[model samples]
Target chain A: MKRRIGAAGLSLFISATLVITGCAQQKILDKMGLSVVIGYDRVDKDRLLGTNVLHQFDPMASESVQIVASTAYTSKGTRDKSNLEMAKKAVSGQLRVTLYSEQLAKEGIINLVDTLARDPTIGARVFLAISKGRAHDILKHRYPEFGNIGTYMYQTISQNIEGESMISPTLHDFMHDYSSVGRDTILPYLEQRGKEGNELVISGAALFQQDRMVGVIPTKEVFYVKLLRDRFQAGSIEISIPREVLGKYMKVSQKKRGNDPIFLVLDTLSSSSTFKLVDKNRPQINTEIKITGRLQEVSEVVDLSKPEIIHKIEKAISQAMMNEGNKVIAKLQKLETDPIGFGEIYRSSVRHSNLTRDKWYEMYRDAKLNLKVEMTLVRTGVIE
Target chain B: MKSIGKPGEHQVFSTFFLFWVIIESQIGMGILQFQRKVVQVAHHDAWISVLITGGVIHVVVWFMIRTLAKYESADLYEIHQHALGKWIGNLLSILYMAYLLLLGTLVLRSYIEVVQTWLFPEIPTWLLSSSVLLLTVYGVLGGIRIIVGVCILSYLFSIALLFFLAYNLPYADWRSLSPVMEANFQELIIGAKQMAFTVVGFEIIYFVYPYLKEKKKAGRYTQMGVLYTTLIYCLVLVLSIAFFSEGQIKKTVWPSLSLFKIVQIPFLERFEYVTVSLWLLVIVPNLLLYLWAATRGMKKVFHWNQRRSVYLSAALVLAICLLLKTNLQIKFLGEWAGQLSLYLVFVYPVILYFIVLIRTRKQRKEVK
Candidate 1:
């Protein structure tokens, strides 16, 4: 009889426990607003002009993504204020991309990016970029071609990263570079252009001295940065070589670029770059880059049957890449930024350099990037 | 003095189970964030600190086993009473039980903190902790074999999570591990000392020694368990140093969990959220092992039923978890436990071993 009473009480306690776990307010998918992309622009002294692009979950909603722009003293404050205007509750669980204007990035966007890194709901892989103009302008505008600008921006940056044309500027990378000594971060620079400034363009990448954007590497020269900074799984580049190099071994004709600098597009390109800190006192980096790819297209009609032509093209491509790489390094030094991670080489190679961000930047200013580019053209088109 | 903890034939388990028992207890909450503490001391050379610390723990565990092996089936509580007189021994045993209860409370607090901050934002502390602590109660209620089953299952399920670190490989700067031995011997030792906090739970061997079916081989299996836990810590600390910048890792509270942030699963939007929820299963063995050890001591010291003591321990740990509502309190709780275990778990066992050694030598002399 006593055992039966104990069993009845235990059953009641077990059933009661279930109700307590479900007490938190339910976030039904349809009713909750998922903030997909957020843009933060600096306002007055203590406030930030924040823009949130809400993903459309309702079928009947006319617009694809709802844009909410507001100013707040803190990042979360902006979220709460944006929530006041939205019908559904705004949540950051699906936030994919965060944009900061060049103006904001100049002052340093770590304060904003840290919150993203701190939020467990926000992914470390979220694309972090810099806008040419106000970040609000890039996020709030609607284009005639695309419905969801936020996702389009995410897809563009991600596909390019996958394509190996750009270095990753993820929240993880940003925090890693920010907290790590000796290395700085580079972020993809975005601008809205093409008639009424609604079309999105990836013009360049912003070179950051620590957290602040110090200079920009144009889209054309970004190849050189990627070449030095990261290894390519599979990347392609269009190199315009002087017609003289190829003219030696193969018949060349001028069709474009006036001087007939033949546009040689190398596809299925893979590369490995090694940085050696031979001269630690002055910081001279001897970079050895080996690139292997097949010829996908030649702007000018050229015969591909001969081995001499392939060797000549390879040599010409190597020389052009070397020159471009040096030029990029020169520009990077002038900007006082070490996006290629010369600081890392300097810190690692030297036993006790006591390298800090400020100290490395000084060394980086005098650092020279000595380049040796080896290019191999395995196959020239489908023919022999 | 009475011979203690000689279980019936049904209660004895194989030495193989000790491996899971050691790792499950050792891996609680610390794996999530130990790198931050060591990084502050050792800087880039934190991995070395972790490796050396792991080496020292092996020796400490050996001494613990030697002491426990002196008795036929007695655990730390019984050994304490035998080594010291009954009052002094039981007092020491009570302090050890308190230490076990504290570790269980800390594991509960930290797991609940992660759950609140990550997966479920509005979860009340009482609800989440009670839900988890109830599992500990249930596991303890079942028996030693049931708890071992949970630890083995916890071991199998949680080992797969380490593969997620592969996602951070592309962004990894292996060069960051450079200037590796730059830290002085003093700094390396300091780093290792800080790491002592994370590696605390392996001393469960003191209580778990008697349950082994083959006591002769328990040393090999127990050492292997500590070795596996050490390797796991070394792997995580090395990866974290490589994946994060020296300055960036210190800013992170839970470096290992942060490593899981970039896990790319096509179907799952955020993998860390899933990981934080799944961690509920991972931390269960920590509670089970600690609470199980505490209740046994409680049963012997108070002469109470082990079942009733299990309830008392779970409720006490739950109350502490409830009172530790803020982050500061949780941090204090961890620091207090880590500091206490540094002496009790690592240093005290060696002292106790010497005491037992002297007492037994004196007893043999008198008999001769």
Candidate 2:
């Protein structure tokens, strides 16, 4: 009976110790500066201007987020400096977006990217973008609609990618492409727009030659880049068909406004791509893209009930896609960036060989690319 | 002496539980980083190396079980005493106890390192280590029955974590594993050697063999356990290779945790935090079983009370873990433990098998 009592007392003492130790380590939500969005800009060749949008959950506070800025030699160094000025300790475990100014990205982002990749606390899904102006300026803009700038930027980028306006490249995806032998990474280019330049916009995609930004593709041409690089789905493209093609079938006046050719807008419902390396020495690639879409808009009245008319439209659309795809491929080749991963495909197809990065780059610079597009019109609009 | 297993006291484990014990032991901290280690050596052909390693382990396990079966209802400690005599056997048993204690320490320290890096950076090492050690003490005091129960429960709870790996399929590029057999035989062997540590947990069967209800069926069940572990290792390795490129896998320290970074549930933003927390369940069983084995060995060798020996072993593990504070020291400790286990589980088993075989032959000759 005495031993039982002593065991009970010991157990009580252990539980009491556990309870005391547990509370000392408790990270109360309010006490932590949950940094949701972080932006980096080049202060000089040796320093970085870092800005972070710290999130607060207190209902009584006037603003739920406060922007903090600091200058340091490294990313973590910047965080440490910024923490000294903040009320709460800055935590990056909830980081949603990492933005860099175009100037800084043009210098090199591999160092910052390495820091993110090395930290196991940071998730791989965080969006990484290159801002048109200073990244700190973008972070400073008040996004009243989002309540928090970090969440707002994250949601905007996520929704755009899901809606097929842009390709979503997370930090993990960028690291994969950067580390892989034959591929380079692309990130969404964000810019400030609106009457006062207060609104943030995903302008286009910034292409990288190795780790430095070489150029940007305009938003309108992003579709062609996507068509060449990724399997497409749920994106709409408008193609201008020559008025002469529909001269006999429809009234030519309706096909043209003044001297402009009529535009046929098609909404892609589904798409798939296949690439084959036909030759190794010359490095010729045969790329076939199969697309299925519904006709959303047609300027001229055509006999949609006729299968031949549909076939002609499909041929015209395929021809237009091929022309645009060739132009984009040529541009990417001239820029010496293989975001389309043709070199990766080639590497996978070949046997054991000494295909180094320089060898692939040289081949890609002169490789002949043959593009074939097969479009199937799955449905026409209700008016048709 | 208190009998660990009496005639009819529900002490003997069923064949089904035996299978889980082997699995829970083999699939702990090693699964988290073996992909990177193997890939560092074999490159794209790491999966094949894993298969070869599994086959080699099966042969070693076969030798171990055969040696243990020579003396009925006797563990490795008793077998050592019978074959090597009292003084030499006691020395070997003490070494085995130290080996087991080192195993437990390596596992605990590795797990705590992961937790600190991934989950709680602010929590001190002693706080976390002591909490885990306390739970381990509670579980160990419950004896083998409770340890086996924890193993079974750990298996059931953590088995679903593998299913979460399916999230990586969409991102997996099958071409990354292309040009199969790219690594030559020598490289593949090196890769297999790197895998020796992760697969060493199956050797626990030599200690647990005497506690089985149907000792005759233990070999088959144990093999099944090994086969399941191999399949799991293969699946994780293949997925890791397919998900990350060769260069990327080489750079990642914990490829398994990195793989979990891509798993995004609707309600959960950071899946790895959840995984690391629940992984304590997976880690506790490994710590408990190894410490239990070490304490049991010590009890047999020194004739110490089992409870007192358990306390001593746990304290030893905690002290060693605390002493290895730096990442470099922890890494060295892991490598040292792996090398030691490789010798004990692989090389020593084959040598002991021959000894047992020659002794049996000589005894029959003397009887005639």
- Give per-model CA RMSD: 23.1, 23.4
Give the per-residue lDDT of model 2 (tens digit) for B155-207: 99999999999999999999989899999999999999999999888878877
Q: Which tens-of-lDDT digit does each residue in A1-384 have in candidate 2?
A: 999999999999999998888667667787999999999999987999999898977788888788999999999999999999989999888998999999999998999999998998799998899999899998987765557778888998999888787877798989998888788888999998886776888989999877889889887677876776787767777878766666667765664455556688887446789999999898999999988776778977676645577778888888878888888889888988888888888899898846777888899999999889988775563223
TM-score of chain B of each: 0.98, 0.97
Off by over 4 Å in 1: A1-384
TM-score of model 2 relative to the true fold? 0.50
Alpha carbon lDDT of each predicted model: 0.85, 0.85
Candidate 2's error at B251, in angstroms?
Answer: 1.2
Q: Which prediction has the highest lDDT against the true structure?
A: 1
lDDT of 1 by residue, B192-303 (tens): 9999989988878888877789998889988999999899999888889989888778767677888888888888766787788888778899899899999989888998
